[model samples]
Target: MSKTVVFIQGSPRENGNTRALAALVMETLAQSGVASAEIDATRLQCSHPGCIACGRCQEGPEFRCHVDDGLARAVATLPDYDAVVLSTPVFWLGPTAQAKMCVDRMASLVKCSDAGALATPLRGKILGLFATGATERDENLDILERQYRVMAEYLGMPFVSALFPFCGVPAGQAAADPEFATVARDFGVRLAGMLGGRKCCDP
Candidate 1:
């Protein structure tokens, strides 16, 4: 069976540099013959406006979220995939608001899981990070790296790898960065290989 990969796009621009890089990675994975799905958080309806801090959904299925939004749907089905990839643009030295909300909504799952036990949705799954920034990849990339590392560690998932394409020049300039594209492609190929070569079958 094909290993399913879920890619989360966190940029608001549908065809922006971040999305372009994400597409290239997905294409490379396809060349390796892996099944993949791309979820654009910009198109999803998520309520991160403010934390209501409500206790509702704190006990139900681990995927349940207190807020009613697209995050709930995504969380419900995330466990079915073998690998998860998050692609986002750096906004104010961190992930764009769109992507942050989706990731934060996953808190419900992690909170409900018993310590020392695998988190409900991401247990045994591989997590990958991909990001783009306007300038100073050194700083922005570091922030994203730490964020994903903490996130993966908390979820008890393997932090596989990350691809950072520095596109701080302009809107469509990332395409001109041949080296970045090469790295992105390689990342995709490796991700596909890792998931495809897994011993456990898809659940």
Candidate 2:
């Protein structure tokens, strides 16, 4: 069976450098015969006080967040996909608010039993991170990567790889960098191959 991937875009600017790289990745995945979907975090109807810790999802074996929003619907469908790609731009040395909101909403994946033991529905899933920043320095990127790594670990998911491209580039300029697109596409192809049980270079 062909592997399916969900690419979540966390940037508010639809045409930003992050989205450009994500688009290239998606295109390459499609060429490799891997089905892919894109979710725009900015468009989700998520609000503040995310994940109220209401213990609603813990009440049953089936995990589901009671929040009536797009994020709930998105999380409900994640188990159907083989892998997930998170694409975001660095904002103040971290992910954008939209991205963080989605991340917080993912708490629904964790099911706390009456005994207090925790289990996640996302266990063993493959996760990849793609991020961009306006600065050429890697400090911000390091912070972002660390955050993602921690999240993956908490969820018991494998942090396959991270693609950081188009750094220091202004909006709309990333598309002009042929090398950026080329590298992004290569990473995408490799990711798709990995999902299909064909090992390629490390992400």
Candidate 3:
């Protein structure tokens, strides 16, 4: 069966290294007949008014958010996809502002376990991550990996493998490392297989 894969591009530079890697992944996924959609958060304005103590969404199965913007539209589409991929350039050794805003705005779907809310819509879905950085360093990659893991856990999505490519000294030069592009392609194929096996099509 076919599956939906949503890719969130978090780079402000449209053709930066991070975006190039994300494009490679999308191309690979196309070979598997998976439905793919992409959103460039950097080009869109996403306002994140820190989460309030409100519990409206937890009151029912409805998917709703307080803020209205591109981020809300993107959040509304999450449950419809079998897999989600977040691509971002390393900012201060972690996720960029665009990526962080999108993830933070998803608070509407998360309710405390003891709150007796319905299951999160993201549960059981496959989640993947791709990141690009200026230099290849174990420490910085660790930071990026942990940030994605936290996002997956909070959203109730399965934390899958993360593909990180350290572009050479120059920040936006991932193509310089051809091997990294191959890795991105492989990541895409594997994620597609996981989504197909999970049968995570939304209602």
Model 2 over residues 1-203: C-alpha lDDT tens digits? 87888977888988788888788787778777777898888887754445777777767677778877777777677778888878888889888887777677777778766797769768888788888777754668777888789988878887755556336678756756888777688778778877773333434
Single out the weakest 10-residue window by summed lDDT for candidate 3: 194-203
Clash count for each candidate, listed in order shown: 1, 0, 0
How good is model 3 by TM-score?
A: 0.83
Report lDDT per candidate.
0.74, 0.76, 0.72
Per-residue lDDT for 1-203 in model 3, tens only?
67788888888887687787777777777776777898777765556533454666566656667666677777778778888778877788877887777776666766555766536778888777777766665768777788779878866678766556457434456655678777887787778777663222322
Worst lDDT 10-window in candidate 1: 194-203
Pairing residues by index, what is the TM-score of model 1?
A: 0.85
Q: Find the candidate with the highest TM-score and give its number.
A: 2
Task: Give the candidates in order of TM-score, highest first.
Answer: 2, 1, 3
- Stretches > 4 Å off in candidate 1: 47-51, 112-118, 197-203
lDDT per residue for candidate 1 within 1-203, as digits (tens), equals 87888988888887688887777877777777777898877778766542356767566654577687776677656778898888888888888887877676666666444555544668778888888876766777887888788878877787765546457656655756888788778788778777764322323
Clashing pairs in 1: 134-168
